[model samples]
Structure formats: structure tokens, C-alpha cells
Target: MILFFGTRPGKTVITQLPDTACPYCNQIGTLQVSKTSSYFHLFWIKLFKITTDTIAECSHCKRVYYENEFTEAMRKELP
Candidate 1:
């Protein structure tokens, strides 16, 4: 249920496709993205955009990744 960060209907637990990466440690295994939300208003409410919490985590390092923030991107570089 690969949950896209800052998407609609809230978060969905992802499984079956195999673990991707730590998004922190860059290690691939049992890494999961969590249920969190942010905002983007097109034709809707008052708030145009706001940042909530959509963190990807590294079970190893226990670091929280905020949407594609610094730690998340660095995962790819890990060996």
C-alpha cells in the first residue's frame, strides 16, 4: 500500500511489494512509510498549503523522515 506522501484519503499501510529502503539509513528491509498528512488546496478551503507529518522511518537508525526531506533523499546514497 505504498502511501504517497501528502496525498489524499490519509495513509495506507504498504506491504507485499517488499521493503524499499530506510529513507534514513538507506538500508532496504522492513522500512515502512507512516500515516500522516499535509495540505494542498486547489479549489477548496482557505489554507493554500501547509506541512504536516508524513514520516518515513528507518527501523535501524530510528530516524523520522519528513516527506522527502534531507534524510529521505540520502537513503539512495547508502550502501
Candidate 2:
């Protein structure tokens, strides 16, 4: 018998951060937050979520900010 199991990334949820500016670009209202969840799968079937990652991107300058790079203003906008 053979088994196929691995981890896969789930759908991404995007939300706009109102009254927030990009930390790198300093552009207001151009910051969008994306949340992605990883899940364990067995034979192409999702079993359970492994972890969730949060990131912020600037539409103007296209800067990506990871969880550890978030600023005080960025943290407050997350749900």
C-alpha cells in the first residue's frame, strides 16, 4: 500500500486596512493585509490546519511585510 500526505496552503483572505499607511512607502490607505492558512492533507483531502500566516503589502510600492516586520499601526488593524 502507498500513502500520499503533505501540507498545502489554503485560500488567502485579503482585507484593507483603513486609516493605515505603509511602513515602508508611507502611502495611506494603500496597505492591504492578507492571511493564509496552511493545512495538512492526506490523499488530497485536507485534514486540519497547521498554521496561519499574516502579511501586509503596499499597493503603491509593492512592499511585503511579514508578521515579525509589522509595526504598531499595522498590528492594530488586524482582526
Using all chains and alpha carbons, the TM-scores for the candidates as numbered come to 0.39, 0.88
For residue 38, model 1's alpha carbon misses the true position, in angstroms, by 8.5
lDDT of 1: 0.49
Candidate 1 C-alpha lDDT tens digits along 1-79: 5533432443444422134665445676745556444565444433334544555566678776655573533344323
Q: Candidate 2, overall lDDT?
A: 0.92
Instruction: Score residue 26 of candidate 2 by CA lDDT.
Output: 84
Q: How many residue pairs clash in each candidate?
A: 1, 0
Clash pairs, candidate 2, are none
Alpha carbon lDDT of residue 50, candidate 1? 55
